[model samples]
Target chain A: MSDKKTITFPVEATHVMMFRRSIGDYAVPDTGLEKAAVPPTFPRAVAQFDPDYHLRLKPGEAWFGSGKKPSGVEGKPSSAGGLHAEQHFEFLRPMVPGDVLSVTEHVGKTWEKESKRAGKLVFTERVQEFRDQKGELVCISRGVSVRTERPVDQK
Target chain B: MRLKASQISVGDTFEDILVEDLKRTQLVMYSGTSGDYNPLHTDDIYCREAAGYPGVFAHGMLTMGMTGRVVTDRFGAENVKKYGVRFTNQVWPGDDLKGKAVVDAIRQENGETLIDMTITTTNQKGDVVLSGYATARAEK
Candidate 1:
Protein backbone atom coordinates (compact mmCIF):
# COMPACT_ATOMS: atom_id res chain seq x y z
CA MET A 1 0.00 0.00 0.00
CA SER A 2 2.53 2.58 -1.08
CA ASP A 3 1.20 6.10 -0.82
CA LYS A 4 0.45 8.02 -4.02
CA LYS A 5 -2.81 9.86 -4.63
CA THR A 6 -6.41 9.88 -3.42
CA ILE A 7 -9.75 10.98 -4.83
CA THR A 8 -13.30 11.07 -3.51
CA PHE A 9 -15.93 9.12 -5.42
CA PRO A 10 -19.58 9.56 -4.64
CA VAL A 11 -21.42 6.41 -5.60
CA GLU A 12 -24.70 7.57 -7.11
CA ALA A 13 -27.68 5.37 -7.87
CA THR A 14 -28.32 6.57 -11.43
CA HIS A 15 -24.69 6.07 -12.35
CA VAL A 16 -24.78 2.55 -10.99
CA MET A 17 -27.88 1.90 -13.05
CA MET A 18 -26.12 3.10 -16.19
CA PHE A 19 -23.07 0.97 -15.43
CA ARG A 20 -25.28 -2.11 -15.09
CA ARG A 21 -26.76 -1.47 -18.49
CA SER A 22 -23.36 -0.86 -20.02
CA ILE A 23 -22.30 -4.33 -18.93
CA GLY A 24 -25.63 -5.89 -20.01
CA ASP A 25 -26.83 -7.00 -16.58
CA TYR A 26 -30.61 -6.51 -16.72
CA ALA A 27 -31.84 -9.07 -14.26
CA VAL A 28 -31.52 -6.67 -11.35
CA PRO A 29 -33.91 -3.76 -11.10
CA ASP A 30 -32.46 -0.25 -10.82
CA THR A 31 -35.28 1.17 -8.71
CA GLY A 32 -34.06 0.23 -5.24
CA LEU A 33 -30.94 2.19 -4.37
CA GLU A 34 -30.69 1.20 -0.74
CA LYS A 35 -30.82 -2.51 -1.33
CA ALA A 36 -29.40 -2.41 -4.81
CA ALA A 37 -26.84 -5.11 -5.46
CA VAL A 38 -23.79 -3.57 -7.11
CA PRO A 39 -21.68 -5.50 -9.57
CA PRO A 40 -18.32 -6.84 -8.44
CA THR A 41 -16.32 -4.79 -10.93
CA PHE A 42 -18.03 -1.52 -9.97
CA PRO A 43 -14.87 -0.28 -8.28
CA ARG A 44 -13.27 0.43 -11.62
CA ALA A 45 -15.83 3.19 -12.03
CA VAL A 46 -13.59 5.15 -9.68
CA ALA A 47 -11.97 6.52 -12.77
CA GLN A 48 -14.75 9.08 -12.81
CA PHE A 49 -13.41 10.62 -9.62
CA ASP A 50 -9.91 10.90 -10.96
CA PRO A 51 -9.90 14.38 -12.44
CA ASP A 52 -6.60 13.94 -14.24
CA TYR A 53 -7.42 10.51 -15.63
CA HIS A 54 -5.82 10.37 -19.08
CA LEU A 55 -8.64 8.66 -20.95
CA ARG A 56 -11.38 11.21 -20.24
CA LEU A 57 -11.81 14.39 -22.24
CA LYS A 58 -10.99 17.63 -20.53
CA PRO A 59 -12.78 20.93 -21.17
CA GLY A 60 -10.23 22.67 -23.42
CA GLU A 61 -7.50 20.12 -23.98
CA ALA A 62 -7.18 18.46 -27.35
CA TRP A 63 -8.72 14.99 -27.26
CA PHE A 64 -7.22 12.02 -29.00
CA GLY A 65 -10.41 10.30 -30.18
CA SER A 66 -11.40 11.92 -33.48
CA GLY A 67 -12.56 15.12 -35.18
CA LYS A 68 -12.06 16.60 -38.69
CA LYS A 69 -8.83 14.65 -38.75
CA PRO A 70 -8.13 11.18 -37.41
CA SER A 71 -6.94 12.76 -34.15
CA GLY A 72 -7.48 16.15 -32.56
CA VAL A 73 -4.10 16.31 -30.91
CA GLU A 74 -1.37 18.18 -32.75
CA GLY A 75 0.67 15.04 -33.44
CA LYS A 76 0.30 11.30 -33.42
CA PRO A 77 0.61 9.60 -30.03
CA SER A 78 2.87 6.89 -31.45
CA SER A 79 0.55 4.31 -29.91
CA ALA A 80 -2.66 4.05 -27.95
CA GLY A 81 -2.36 4.23 -24.17
CA GLY A 82 -1.42 0.60 -24.21
CA LEU A 83 -3.77 -2.35 -23.54
CA HIS A 84 -5.27 -3.72 -20.40
CA ALA A 85 -3.52 -6.90 -19.35
CA GLU A 86 -5.12 -7.85 -16.06
CA GLN A 87 -7.69 -6.70 -13.50
CA HIS A 88 -8.58 -8.03 -10.06
CA PHE A 89 -10.90 -7.07 -7.21
CA GLU A 90 -11.05 -8.02 -3.55
CA PHE A 91 -14.06 -7.00 -1.51
CA LEU A 92 -14.01 -6.72 2.25
CA ARG A 93 -17.73 -5.96 2.22
CA PRO A 94 -20.44 -5.31 -0.32
CA MET A 95 -20.15 -1.76 -1.68
CA VAL A 96 -23.59 -0.30 -2.34
CA PRO A 97 -24.76 2.95 -3.83
CA GLY A 98 -24.79 6.03 -1.55
CA ASP A 99 -21.49 5.09 0.01
CA VAL A 100 -18.88 7.75 -0.62
CA LEU A 101 -15.54 6.14 -1.24
CA SER A 102 -12.13 7.68 -0.70
CA VAL A 103 -10.13 6.08 -3.42
CA THR A 104 -6.34 5.90 -3.47
CA GLU A 105 -4.02 4.56 -6.15
CA HIS A 106 -0.43 3.34 -5.91
CA VAL A 107 2.02 2.00 -8.42
CA GLY A 108 2.51 -1.68 -7.72
CA LYS A 109 4.83 -3.56 -10.11
CA THR A 110 6.53 -3.12 -13.49
CA TRP A 111 8.28 -5.52 -15.82
CA GLU A 112 9.16 -6.20 -19.44
CA LYS A 113 8.93 -9.22 -21.71
CA GLU A 114 9.36 -10.08 -25.35
CA SER A 115 6.22 -11.11 -27.18
CA LYS A 116 5.73 -12.47 -30.70
CA ARG A 117 2.21 -11.14 -31.08
CA ALA A 118 2.93 -7.54 -30.02
CA GLY A 119 6.73 -7.26 -29.89
CA LYS A 120 8.27 -6.13 -26.58
CA LEU A 121 5.70 -5.73 -23.79
CA VAL A 122 6.06 -3.40 -20.83
CA PHE A 123 3.60 -4.07 -18.02
CA THR A 124 2.71 -1.80 -15.13
CA GLU A 125 0.41 -2.63 -12.25
CA ARG A 126 -1.73 -0.03 -10.52
CA VAL A 127 -3.40 -0.81 -7.21
CA GLN A 128 -6.36 1.05 -5.84
CA GLU A 129 -7.95 0.91 -2.42
CA PHE A 130 -11.54 2.01 -1.94
CA ARG A 131 -12.46 3.06 1.55
CA ASP A 132 -15.82 4.06 2.94
CA GLN A 133 -16.45 7.33 4.75
CA LYS A 134 -15.61 5.61 8.01
CA GLY A 135 -12.11 4.92 6.66
CA GLU A 136 -12.78 1.23 6.39
CA LEU A 137 -11.56 -0.65 3.38
CA VAL A 138 -14.41 -1.57 1.09
CA CYS A 139 -12.51 -2.96 -1.85
CA ILE A 140 -9.09 -3.37 -3.44
CA SER A 141 -8.52 -3.27 -7.19
CA ARG A 142 -5.35 -4.30 -8.99
CA GLY A 143 -5.03 -3.57 -12.69
CA VAL A 144 -2.21 -4.19 -15.13
CA SER A 145 -1.74 -2.18 -18.31
CA VAL A 146 0.70 -3.10 -21.04
CA ARG A 147 2.40 -1.13 -23.82
CA THR A 148 3.62 -3.00 -26.86
CA GLU A 149 6.53 -2.05 -29.09
CA ARG A 150 4.11 -2.18 -32.01
CA PRO A 151 0.51 -2.90 -32.75
CA VAL A 152 -0.43 -6.52 -32.16
CA ASP A 153 -0.36 -8.64 -35.31
CA GLN A 154 -3.97 -9.21 -36.31
CA LYS A 155 -3.18 -12.55 -37.92
CA MET B 1 -29.70 -16.43 -4.76
CA ARG B 2 -26.53 -17.49 -3.02
CA LEU B 3 -24.85 -20.76 -3.84
CA LYS B 4 -25.38 -23.37 -1.17
CA ALA B 5 -22.45 -25.41 0.03
CA SER B 6 -24.78 -28.34 0.53
CA GLN B 7 -26.07 -28.27 -3.04
CA ILE B 8 -23.00 -27.51 -5.15
CA SER B 9 -19.97 -29.60 -6.08
CA VAL B 10 -16.40 -28.77 -7.12
CA GLY B 11 -16.98 -29.58 -10.79
CA ASP B 12 -20.31 -27.74 -11.11
CA THR B 13 -20.21 -25.11 -13.84
CA PHE B 14 -22.30 -22.10 -14.87
CA GLU B 15 -22.29 -20.31 -18.22
CA ASP B 16 -23.85 -17.35 -20.02
CA ILE B 17 -23.61 -15.70 -23.40
CA LEU B 18 -22.08 -12.37 -22.47
CA VAL B 19 -22.74 -10.71 -25.80
CA GLU B 20 -23.76 -11.53 -29.38
CA ASP B 21 -22.54 -9.77 -32.54
CA LEU B 22 -21.04 -7.06 -30.36
CA LYS B 23 -21.84 -3.59 -31.65
CA ARG B 24 -19.71 -0.46 -31.77
CA THR B 25 -22.43 1.36 -29.88
CA GLN B 26 -21.93 -1.13 -27.06
CA LEU B 27 -18.30 -0.08 -26.91
CA VAL B 28 -19.34 3.57 -26.79
CA MET B 29 -21.78 2.81 -24.02
CA TYR B 30 -19.02 1.18 -22.02
CA SER B 31 -16.70 4.13 -22.62
CA GLY B 32 -19.31 6.58 -21.47
CA THR B 33 -20.08 4.72 -18.27
CA SER B 34 -16.49 3.73 -17.46
CA GLY B 35 -15.00 7.20 -18.13
CA ASP B 36 -12.49 5.52 -20.40
CA TYR B 37 -12.54 7.49 -23.64
CA ASN B 38 -9.71 5.43 -25.11
CA PRO B 39 -10.04 5.76 -28.89
CA LEU B 40 -8.82 2.23 -29.33
CA HIS B 41 -12.26 1.14 -28.26
CA THR B 42 -14.51 3.67 -30.00
CA ASP B 43 -12.72 5.80 -32.57
CA ASP B 44 -12.36 4.08 -35.92
CA ILE B 45 -10.32 6.67 -37.82
CA TYR B 46 -7.95 7.27 -34.94
CA CYS B 47 -7.39 3.56 -34.48
CA ARG B 48 -6.83 2.96 -38.16
CA GLU B 49 -4.52 5.90 -38.82
CA ALA B 50 -2.78 6.37 -35.48
CA ALA B 51 -2.91 3.27 -33.31
CA GLY B 52 -2.57 1.02 -36.38
CA TYR B 53 -5.33 -1.38 -35.41
CA PRO B 54 -7.91 -2.47 -37.97
CA GLY B 55 -10.55 -0.65 -35.96
CA VAL B 56 -11.84 -0.22 -32.43
CA PHE B 57 -11.67 -3.09 -29.96
CA ALA B 58 -13.44 -3.69 -26.66
CA HIS B 59 -11.91 -2.49 -23.43
CA GLY B 60 -10.45 -5.32 -21.39
CA MET B 61 -12.41 -4.06 -18.42
CA LEU B 62 -15.61 -4.21 -20.42
CA THR B 63 -14.99 -7.85 -21.22
CA MET B 64 -14.09 -8.51 -17.58
CA GLY B 65 -17.23 -6.75 -16.45
CA MET B 66 -19.40 -8.88 -18.73
CA THR B 67 -17.64 -12.11 -17.84
CA GLY B 68 -18.28 -11.43 -14.16
CA ARG B 69 -22.02 -11.99 -14.50
CA VAL B 70 -21.49 -15.72 -14.87
CA VAL B 71 -20.01 -15.80 -11.37
CA THR B 72 -22.12 -13.12 -9.75
CA ASP B 73 -25.34 -14.72 -10.97
CA ARG B 74 -24.53 -17.96 -9.23
CA PHE B 75 -23.09 -16.68 -5.94
CA GLY B 76 -24.64 -13.21 -5.87
CA ALA B 77 -22.50 -10.07 -6.11
CA GLU B 78 -22.65 -9.41 -2.37
CA ASN B 79 -21.24 -12.82 -1.58
CA VAL B 80 -18.24 -12.48 -3.83
CA LYS B 81 -15.00 -11.78 -1.99
CA LYS B 82 -12.50 -11.93 -4.82
CA TYR B 83 -12.70 -11.59 -8.58
CA GLY B 84 -9.85 -11.27 -11.06
CA VAL B 85 -9.05 -11.85 -14.73
CA ARG B 86 -6.35 -11.70 -17.40
CA PHE B 87 -7.04 -10.49 -20.91
CA THR B 88 -5.87 -13.35 -23.10
CA ASN B 89 -6.98 -11.91 -26.44
CA GLN B 90 -8.60 -8.82 -27.91
CA VAL B 91 -12.37 -8.70 -28.52
CA TRP B 92 -13.54 -7.11 -31.73
CA PRO B 93 -16.77 -5.32 -32.70
CA GLY B 94 -18.68 -8.22 -34.29
CA ASP B 95 -17.36 -10.93 -32.02
CA ASP B 96 -19.68 -13.03 -29.89
CA LEU B 97 -18.69 -13.89 -26.33
CA LYS B 98 -19.54 -16.70 -23.93
CA GLY B 99 -18.34 -17.00 -20.34
CA LYS B 100 -18.14 -20.00 -18.01
CA ALA B 101 -17.55 -20.28 -14.26
CA VAL B 102 -16.61 -23.64 -12.82
CA VAL B 103 -16.48 -24.37 -9.14
CA ASP B 104 -12.97 -25.47 -8.22
CA ALA B 105 -13.03 -25.89 -4.47
CA ILE B 106 -15.16 -25.44 -1.35
CA ARG B 107 -13.76 -24.85 2.07
CA GLN B 108 -14.60 -23.76 5.60
CA GLU B 109 -12.76 -20.76 6.97
CA ASN B 110 -13.58 -19.25 10.36
CA GLY B 111 -16.85 -21.24 10.29
CA GLU B 112 -17.89 -19.59 7.00
CA THR B 113 -18.32 -21.57 3.80
CA LEU B 114 -16.65 -20.38 0.59
CA ILE B 115 -16.27 -21.59 -2.95
CA ASP B 116 -13.38 -21.00 -5.35
CA MET B 117 -14.09 -20.99 -9.05
CA THR B 118 -12.21 -20.74 -12.33
CA ILE B 119 -13.49 -18.34 -15.00
CA THR B 120 -13.12 -18.43 -18.76
CA THR B 121 -14.58 -16.35 -21.59
CA THR B 122 -14.35 -17.44 -25.23
CA ASN B 123 -15.10 -15.80 -28.56
CA GLN B 124 -17.03 -17.33 -31.47
CA LYS B 125 -13.94 -19.05 -32.89
CA GLY B 126 -13.31 -20.76 -29.54
CA ASP B 127 -10.39 -18.45 -28.78
CA VAL B 128 -10.07 -17.69 -25.08
CA VAL B 129 -10.42 -13.96 -24.54
CA LEU B 130 -10.33 -13.76 -20.76
CA SER B 131 -9.36 -16.16 -18.01
CA GLY B 132 -9.24 -15.74 -14.23
CA TYR B 133 -10.63 -16.89 -10.86
CA ALA B 134 -13.08 -15.89 -8.17
CA THR B 135 -13.89 -16.71 -4.55
CA ALA B 136 -17.25 -16.19 -2.91
CA ARG B 137 -19.16 -16.96 0.24
CA ALA B 138 -21.70 -19.79 0.17
CA GLU B 139 -24.67 -20.60 2.32
CA LYS B 140 -23.82 -23.15 4.92
Candidate 2:
Protein backbone atom coordinates (compact mmCIF):
# COMPACT_ATOMS: atom_id res chain seq x y z
CA MET A 1 0.00 0.00 0.00
CA SER A 2 1.24 3.48 -0.86
CA ASP A 3 1.89 5.70 2.19
CA LYS A 4 0.57 3.33 4.81
CA LYS A 5 1.42 3.01 8.52
CA THR A 6 0.43 0.71 11.39
CA ILE A 7 0.22 1.16 15.16
CA THR A 8 -1.23 -0.28 18.42
CA PHE A 9 -2.28 0.84 21.94
CA PRO A 10 -2.83 -1.15 25.11
CA VAL A 11 -5.86 -0.91 27.39
CA GLU A 12 -5.24 -1.06 31.12
CA ALA A 13 -6.92 -3.11 33.83
CA THR A 14 -8.34 -0.08 35.60
CA HIS A 15 -9.78 1.15 32.33
CA VAL A 16 -11.45 -2.01 31.02
CA MET A 17 -14.72 -1.76 32.96
CA MET A 18 -14.57 1.98 33.39
CA PHE A 19 -17.57 4.08 32.43
CA ARG A 20 -19.04 7.47 33.23
CA ARG A 21 -22.28 6.06 34.44
CA SER A 22 -25.25 8.36 34.44
CA ILE A 23 -25.53 7.25 38.05
CA GLY A 24 -22.78 5.92 40.30
CA ASP A 25 -19.74 7.00 42.33
CA TYR A 26 -17.74 7.51 39.11
CA ALA A 27 -20.56 9.37 37.39
CA VAL A 28 -19.24 11.98 34.96
CA PRO A 29 -21.72 13.84 32.83
CA ASP A 30 -21.06 15.53 29.52
CA THR A 31 -19.58 18.84 30.67
CA GLY A 32 -18.50 20.81 27.60
CA LEU A 33 -16.71 17.72 26.34
CA GLU A 34 -19.35 15.84 24.38
CA LYS A 35 -23.03 15.96 23.70
CA ALA A 36 -24.85 15.21 26.92
CA ALA A 37 -26.12 11.96 25.52
CA VAL A 38 -22.70 10.72 24.39
CA PRO A 39 -20.96 9.70 27.58
CA PRO A 40 -17.21 9.75 27.25
CA THR A 41 -15.26 6.52 27.87
CA PHE A 42 -11.82 7.99 27.19
CA PRO A 43 -10.90 8.36 30.85
CA ARG A 44 -11.46 4.70 31.53
CA ALA A 45 -9.78 3.58 28.31
CA VAL A 46 -6.63 5.71 28.52
CA ALA A 47 -6.08 5.48 32.27
CA GLN A 48 -5.00 1.86 31.91
CA PHE A 49 -1.63 2.75 30.33
CA ASP A 50 -1.00 6.48 30.30
CA PRO A 51 -1.38 7.86 33.78
CA ASP A 52 0.21 11.21 33.17
CA TYR A 53 -2.10 11.85 30.20
CA HIS A 54 0.86 12.84 28.06
CA LEU A 55 -0.25 13.31 24.43
CA ARG A 56 -3.54 11.61 25.11
CA LEU A 57 -6.84 13.35 24.51
CA LYS A 58 -8.87 14.29 27.54
CA PRO A 59 -12.39 13.05 28.11
CA GLY A 60 -14.93 13.91 25.35
CA GLU A 61 -12.20 14.28 22.77
CA ALA A 62 -12.49 12.49 19.45
CA TRP A 63 -10.50 9.41 18.49
CA PHE A 64 -9.33 8.34 15.01
CA GLY A 65 -9.24 11.14 12.45
CA SER A 66 -10.67 14.44 13.57
CA GLY A 67 -13.20 15.36 10.90
CA LYS A 68 -12.38 19.07 10.93
CA LYS A 69 -8.73 19.35 11.87
CA PRO A 70 -5.49 17.44 11.55
CA SER A 71 -5.21 14.69 14.14
CA GLY A 72 -1.54 15.74 14.38
CA VAL A 73 -0.05 12.32 13.56
CA GLU A 74 2.94 13.43 11.52
CA GLY A 75 6.29 11.69 11.04
CA LYS A 76 5.14 9.23 13.67
CA PRO A 77 4.48 5.54 13.24
CA SER A 78 0.94 4.67 12.22
CA SER A 79 0.23 3.26 15.64
CA ALA A 80 0.94 6.70 17.03
CA GLY A 81 1.52 4.80 20.23
CA GLY A 82 -2.17 4.76 21.32
CA LEU A 83 -4.15 6.02 18.38
CA HIS A 84 -7.00 3.67 17.61
CA ALA A 85 -9.79 3.20 15.10
CA GLU A 86 -13.15 1.91 16.25
CA GLN A 87 -12.44 -0.13 19.37
CA HIS A 88 -14.54 -3.30 19.48
CA PHE A 89 -14.69 -4.17 23.15
CA GLU A 90 -15.60 -7.81 23.68
CA PHE A 91 -16.46 -8.18 27.33
CA LEU A 92 -15.48 -11.73 28.14
CA ARG A 93 -15.72 -10.89 31.82
CA PRO A 94 -17.23 -8.00 33.64
CA MET A 95 -14.69 -5.72 35.31
CA VAL A 96 -15.81 -4.03 38.48
CA PRO A 97 -14.50 -1.27 40.66
CA GLY A 98 -11.09 -1.97 42.26
CA ASP A 99 -10.46 -4.68 39.69
CA VAL A 100 -7.24 -3.93 37.90
CA LEU A 101 -6.90 -4.48 34.11
CA SER A 102 -4.15 -4.39 31.47
CA VAL A 103 -4.15 -4.28 27.70
CA THR A 104 -1.64 -5.06 24.91
CA GLU A 105 -2.03 -3.73 21.41
CA HIS A 106 -0.63 -4.55 17.96
CA VAL A 107 -1.25 -3.11 14.54
CA GLY A 108 -2.83 -5.98 12.68
CA LYS A 109 -3.46 -4.34 9.28
CA THR A 110 -2.98 -1.18 7.25
CA TRP A 111 -4.26 0.24 3.96
CA GLU A 112 -4.86 3.44 2.02
CA LYS A 113 -7.89 5.02 0.32
CA GLU A 114 -8.46 8.02 -1.93
CA SER A 115 -10.72 10.74 -0.59
CA LYS A 116 -11.96 13.84 -2.37
CA ARG A 117 -10.99 16.46 0.20
CA ALA A 118 -8.45 14.58 2.29
CA GLY A 119 -6.47 13.40 -0.76
CA LYS A 120 -5.16 10.01 0.38
CA LEU A 121 -6.77 8.59 3.49
CA VAL A 122 -4.30 6.28 5.17
CA PHE A 123 -6.03 3.76 7.42
CA THR A 124 -4.60 1.52 10.11
CA GLU A 125 -6.17 -1.38 11.91
CA ARG A 126 -5.27 -1.90 15.55
CA VAL A 127 -6.13 -4.81 17.77
CA GLN A 128 -6.00 -4.46 21.56
CA GLU A 129 -6.31 -7.29 24.07
CA PHE A 130 -7.45 -6.61 27.61
CA ARG A 131 -6.67 -8.76 30.60
CA ASP A 132 -7.44 -8.68 34.28
CA GLN A 133 -4.93 -8.42 37.10
CA LYS A 134 -4.58 -12.17 36.96
CA GLY A 135 -3.67 -11.89 33.28
CA GLU A 136 -6.85 -13.50 32.02
CA LEU A 137 -7.98 -12.28 28.63
CA VAL A 138 -10.96 -10.07 29.30
CA CYS A 139 -11.69 -8.21 26.10
CA ILE A 140 -10.52 -7.55 22.55
CA SER A 141 -11.06 -4.17 20.84
CA ARG A 142 -10.40 -3.61 17.13
CA GLY A 143 -10.06 -0.09 15.83
CA VAL A 144 -9.67 1.63 12.42
CA SER A 145 -8.21 5.10 11.94
CA VAL A 146 -7.52 7.28 8.93
CA ARG A 147 -4.64 9.69 8.37
CA THR A 148 -4.55 12.43 5.83
CA GLU A 149 -2.97 15.77 4.91
CA ARG A 150 -3.26 18.36 7.66
CA PRO A 151 -5.98 20.89 7.10
CA VAL A 152 -4.96 24.46 6.56
CA ASP A 153 -6.31 25.48 9.94
CA GLN A 154 -4.37 22.69 11.64
CA LYS A 155 -1.09 23.12 9.77
CA MET B 1 -31.92 -19.66 42.23
CA ARG B 2 -28.43 -19.75 40.79
CA LEU B 3 -28.47 -19.54 36.98
CA LYS B 4 -26.54 -22.41 35.44
CA ALA B 5 -26.54 -24.31 32.21
CA SER B 6 -27.55 -27.61 33.81
CA GLN B 7 -30.48 -25.86 35.47
CA ILE B 8 -31.61 -24.62 32.04
CA SER B 9 -32.64 -27.36 29.69
CA VAL B 10 -31.52 -27.06 26.10
CA GLY B 11 -35.10 -26.53 24.89
CA ASP B 12 -35.90 -24.21 27.79
CA THR B 13 -36.66 -20.70 26.61
CA PHE B 14 -35.42 -17.60 28.35
CA GLU B 15 -37.51 -14.50 28.93
CA ASP B 16 -38.29 -12.47 25.83
CA ILE B 17 -36.66 -9.02 25.79
CA LEU B 18 -38.36 -6.27 23.85
CA VAL B 19 -37.41 -2.67 23.06
CA GLU B 20 -40.41 -0.70 21.86
CA ASP B 21 -40.35 2.01 19.20
CA LEU B 22 -36.65 2.45 18.46
CA LYS B 23 -36.25 6.08 17.48
CA ARG B 24 -34.54 7.28 14.34
CA THR B 25 -32.59 9.69 16.49
CA GLN B 26 -31.15 6.77 18.42
CA LEU B 27 -29.74 5.33 15.20
CA VAL B 28 -28.37 8.70 14.18
CA MET B 29 -26.66 9.28 17.49
CA TYR B 30 -25.18 5.79 17.38
CA SER B 31 -23.80 6.44 13.91
CA GLY B 32 -22.19 9.72 14.96
CA THR B 33 -20.49 8.21 17.98
CA SER B 34 -19.58 4.84 16.47
CA GLY B 35 -18.10 6.33 13.26
CA ASP B 36 -20.17 4.01 11.12
CA TYR B 37 -21.27 6.44 8.44
CA ASN B 38 -23.13 3.84 6.44
CA PRO B 39 -25.94 5.47 4.48
CA LEU B 40 -28.23 2.60 5.39
CA HIS B 41 -28.36 3.92 8.95
CA THR B 42 -28.59 7.70 8.70
CA ASP B 43 -29.97 8.45 5.27
CA ASP B 44 -33.69 8.00 5.56
CA ILE B 45 -34.27 8.63 1.85
CA TYR B 46 -31.67 6.10 0.91
CA CYS B 47 -33.06 3.59 3.36
CA ARG B 48 -36.67 3.89 2.22
CA GLU B 49 -36.43 4.58 -1.51
CA ALA B 50 -33.04 3.25 -2.48
CA ALA B 51 -32.14 0.47 -0.03
CA GLY B 52 -35.80 -0.74 0.07
CA TYR B 53 -35.72 -0.69 3.86
CA PRO B 54 -38.73 0.71 5.66
CA GLY B 55 -36.51 3.38 7.14
CA VAL B 56 -33.02 3.86 8.50
CA PHE B 57 -31.85 0.93 10.60
CA ALA B 58 -30.01 0.62 13.87
CA HIS B 59 -26.38 -0.33 14.16
CA GLY B 60 -25.79 -3.97 14.99
CA MET B 61 -23.38 -2.80 17.68
CA LEU B 62 -26.12 -0.88 19.47
CA THR B 63 -28.24 -3.99 19.69
CA MET B 64 -25.20 -6.06 20.71
CA GLY B 65 -24.26 -3.46 23.29
CA MET B 66 -27.73 -3.72 24.77
CA THR B 67 -27.28 -7.47 25.02
CA GLY B 68 -24.07 -6.88 26.87
CA ARG B 69 -26.07 -4.66 29.17
CA VAL B 70 -28.48 -7.51 29.81
CA VAL B 71 -25.67 -9.94 30.61
CA THR B 72 -23.98 -7.47 32.93
CA ASP B 73 -27.24 -6.64 34.62
CA ARG B 74 -28.24 -10.29 34.98
CA PHE B 75 -25.01 -11.88 36.27
CA GLY B 76 -23.04 -8.80 37.20
CA ALA B 77 -19.89 -7.90 35.30
CA GLU B 78 -17.47 -10.08 37.26
CA ASN B 79 -19.35 -13.27 36.44
CA VAL B 80 -19.16 -12.73 32.70
CA LYS B 81 -16.30 -14.75 31.24
CA LYS B 82 -16.64 -13.83 27.57
CA TYR B 83 -19.31 -12.38 25.26
CA GLY B 84 -19.36 -12.29 21.45
CA VAL B 85 -21.85 -12.52 18.59
CA ARG B 86 -22.25 -12.23 14.84
CA PHE B 87 -24.97 -10.07 13.30
CA THR B 88 -27.31 -12.03 11.06
CA ASN B 89 -30.09 -9.56 10.19
CA GLN B 90 -30.69 -5.86 9.96
CA VAL B 91 -32.79 -4.16 12.66
CA TRP B 92 -34.78 -1.43 11.02
CA PRO B 93 -35.63 1.80 12.82
CA GLY B 94 -39.02 2.06 14.55
CA ASP B 95 -39.40 -1.70 14.71
CA ASP B 96 -39.98 -3.21 18.11
CA LEU B 97 -37.00 -5.55 18.58
CA LYS B 98 -37.20 -8.57 20.84
CA GLY B 99 -34.33 -10.60 22.26
CA LYS B 100 -34.31 -14.15 23.53
CA ALA B 101 -31.45 -16.15 24.99
CA VAL B 102 -31.58 -19.92 25.35
CA VAL B 103 -29.38 -22.39 27.10
CA ASP B 104 -27.48 -24.36 24.50
CA ALA B 105 -25.36 -26.43 26.86
CA ILE B 106 -23.42 -26.32 30.12
CA ARG B 107 -20.00 -27.70 30.95
CA GLN B 108 -17.84 -27.52 34.05
CA GLU B 109 -14.12 -28.07 34.19
CA ASN B 110 -11.67 -27.66 37.06
CA GLY B 111 -14.21 -25.78 39.22
CA GLU B 112 -15.06 -23.38 36.39
CA THR B 113 -18.64 -23.25 35.18
CA LEU B 114 -19.18 -22.45 31.53
CA ILE B 115 -22.75 -21.92 30.37
CA ASP B 116 -23.21 -21.76 26.64
CA MET B 117 -25.99 -19.34 25.77
CA THR B 118 -27.62 -18.72 22.41
CA ILE B 119 -28.96 -15.23 21.80
CA THR B 120 -31.40 -14.20 19.10
CA THR B 121 -32.78 -10.77 18.18
CA THR B 122 -35.96 -10.49 16.18
CA ASN B 123 -38.21 -7.79 14.84
CA GLN B 124 -41.70 -7.09 16.14
CA LYS B 125 -42.99 -9.44 13.48
CA GLY B 126 -40.86 -12.22 15.00
CA ASP B 127 -38.41 -12.14 12.12
CA VAL B 128 -34.94 -13.02 13.40
CA VAL B 129 -32.39 -10.28 12.88
CA LEU B 130 -29.30 -11.56 14.68
CA SER B 131 -28.29 -14.74 16.43
CA GLY B 132 -25.18 -15.83 18.31
CA TYR B 133 -23.88 -17.50 21.45
CA ALA B 134 -22.20 -16.48 24.71
CA THR B 135 -19.97 -18.30 27.21
CA ALA B 136 -20.12 -17.26 30.86
CA ARG B 137 -18.54 -18.54 34.08
CA ALA B 138 -20.65 -19.80 36.93
CA GLU B 139 -19.94 -18.40 40.35
CA LYS B 140 -18.70 -20.86 42.88
Best by lDDT: 1
Task: Score residue A39 of candidate 2 by CA lDDT.
Answer: 18
Candidate 2 chain B weakest ten by summed lDDT: B45-54
Question: After superposing the true interface residues, what Cα RMSD does each candidate give?
Answer: 1.0, 10.9
Identify the candidate with maximal TM-score.
1
Residue A153 CA displacement from its true place in model 2, Å: 42
Record all residue pairs in model 1 with backbone atoms less than 3 Å apart, i.e. clashing.
none
lDDT (Cα, tens digit) per residue for candidate 2, span A1-117 = 112321223332322322323111122233433222211122124332433333334467543333333232334332232212233445555544444456555677888767564
Task: Compute the interface RMSD for candidate 2.
Answer: 10.9
Please give the range of 10 consecutive residues that has the lowest summed lDDT in model 1 chain A.
A27-36
Badly placed stretches (over 4 Å) of model 1 are A1-3, A30-34, A74-77
Cand. 1 Cα-lDDT? 0.88
DockQ value for model 2? 0.09
Please give the C-alpha DockQ score of model 1. 0.84
